[model samples]
Target: MMSSPPAASPQALLRRLLSGVARVFVVPVSADGQLLLHRHESDRHCYWTYPTMQRGTMRTDPATVARRLLREELGAESGVLRLVHVLPAARTHARSAVYAASLDLPAAEILAAREATGTSRRALQGLAVTAETLVALDVRPLAINDLMTTGGIPARTLLALPDLADPASTVNQPG
Candidate 1:
C-alpha cells in the first residue's frame, strides 16, 4: 500500500492557496463615458459588479488575462486594455488584479454579444451607469467604487473614465 503524504502546515497551505488563486476585475468603459457592470441572474447575494474574471494561471500576464476576460465576458475585443491596479493577496481574497479597457462599442452592442456568445458562467446583464448613478445606487463589492475613488490605486489611471467622475455627458443610459 502507498503511504499517505504528510499534512501540509498552515503556512504552506496558505501559500498554496494564494498561489493557486488569481482573479481579475475588469472595468469596461464605453466611448460615451459609461461603466459596465454585470449581474448574474443566479447571484442573489450581490446586485451588480464590474465584470470579474479568474486568471487561468499565475504566469499569465495581467493584460492578457484582462483581454481574455473581455473576450469571454463581453464577446468582443477591440479595446486597449491596461493594468490599472493590483490588489495584493493580503488585501484581496485571491490576489485580484484590476484592469481598465476602453471599448469603442456601446453597452447595447456589448450586451448583445454577451447574449449571443453565452460564454459567462451565468446569464449576465450588463448595465452602463454614470459615476453619480453608480455611487447613488451603492452597488455591492464596494471595492469597485473604492478602486475608482481613493482605493490606493492611481487616480490618473482611472481619471480618463467619465464614470469615475461626476456625471457630465450622458453616454449610454443605464439599463
Candidate 2:
C-alpha cells in the first residue's frame, strides 16, 4: 500500500508564507514636511515610495527592512519609524508594509545620496514635495492611489505637516 505524504514542517510553512510577503514601502518625510518621492530615469511620472526590497528567506521584520532601505537608498537614519499600513498583494507576488519615517536632513542632501548610491539597474530620481504638490502630480505605481483611498496613511502623518512649514521646528527631530 502507498503511504500518505508527511505533513510539512512548521518552519517550512513559515518560510513559504514569508517567501514573497516581506516587501516594505515607506513615506519619507523631510524636515519641511514634504514627502520624498521617486521617479524612474526612464519614466515620466513621479510617486511617493520608500525604499523597497524582497525579504526572501531572511526572516527580518518590516521595521528592520525599512531601516536597511533608508541606509541603502537615502544614506540616512532615524530613531523611530511608525507603521502606517500593510498593503496586501493585489495582483503581484508580494505584499508590502508601509511606514512613516521622518528624516532630519535636507531633501537635496537625500537626493544626492540616492543618486550617488543608485546603479543603472536601480536608477531613480528623488524629489520632495508638499501634499498639495503630490495631489497635483500624475503619480504612478497605482498602489499610491489605493493607499490614499483605503485610509492607509495614518492621521498622524497629516498632523505632522504644519510643523514642517517651519524650518526651525523640532517636531520630527530624530532621537
Candidate 3:
C-alpha cells in the first residue's frame, strides 16, 4: 500500500518547527509613548517587530517565561512589565504573550543588564527603531498595522483572533 505524502507548506513547516515556543512582543515605548521596534531577519516578510520575546529554556509559566525571553531577546533587566494580552495556542503549537514595557536606562545601565543576563550578542544585532520606521519599512504591521488598516479591532488582538485575550480571566485583575 502506498502512503500519502506529508501535507504541510514550507511556511507551515517552519512554523511547526517554531511551534510550542512561547514568545512575547514587547511594545517598548519612548518616554513620549512612541512604540519601539526593530528589524527581524527571520521573518523576512517584514523588516520589523515589537521588542519581542523568545523562548529561553523550555519553561511555560507566563511571567517567568516572559521575563526570561525579554532578557534573552532584548537584554532587559528586571523592570516593570505590563501584560497587554495572552494568546493561547493559536495554530496548534505555540502560545504568545503580548506586553508593553518602558525602559529609561542609559548606555551603562543597558550594558549592565546585558552582562547580567548574558545577552550581549543578541542586542548587537538589533536596532531601536521607532514605530514610524516600521511603517516606512512596511513591516507587515502584525498588530497595530492591522488595526490601522482594518479599522476594526485592535490589530494586536486581531491577528491572534479567536485565541486573543487570556483564556482564564473574565475580569481585569491585578498582577
TM per candidate: 0.63, 0.60, 0.46
Ranking by TM-score: 1, 2, 3
Tell me the spans in candidate 1 whose CA falls farther than 4 Å from its real position: 1-21, 41-46, 56-58, 90-92, 138-140, 150-175
Where does model 2 exceed 4 Å of error? 1-20, 43-49, 113-133, 145-175
Per-residue alpha-carbon lDDT of candidate 1 for residues 1-175, written as tens digits (9 for 90 to 100): 9999999775564344345438878887765555666764453445667777777656775557778888877776846565545566664356776667777787777777677767675545545444555566645456667666543222233634443211343333222
| Per-residue alpha-carbon lDDT of candidate 2 for residues 1-175, written as tens digits (9 for 90 to 100) | 9999999875575445434556777677665545565554436643434457676577686678888877776667864466555566777435766666777776777667766766223544444444454455655545643444323232234323332112254554232
Q: lDDT per residue, candidate 3, 1-175, as tens digits?
A: 9999989775565344445547765554333333445545553363655555556565554456656655666566434555555546654224666655544554455555566777645433233343344445654235544332333222222232332223343332111
State the C-alpha lDDT per candidate.
0.60, 0.56, 0.48
- Measured with C-alpha atoms, the lDDT of residue 147 in candidate 2 is 49
Give residue 142's error in model 3 in angstroms.
0.8
Candidate 1 yields a Cα-based lDDT of 0.60
Best by lDDT: 1
Error of 3 at 20 (Å): 8.6
After superposing candidate 3 on the true structure, give the runs of residues whose Cα lies further than 4 Å from its correct spot.
1-21, 30-36, 40-46, 53-59, 88-93, 106-118, 123-134, 144-175
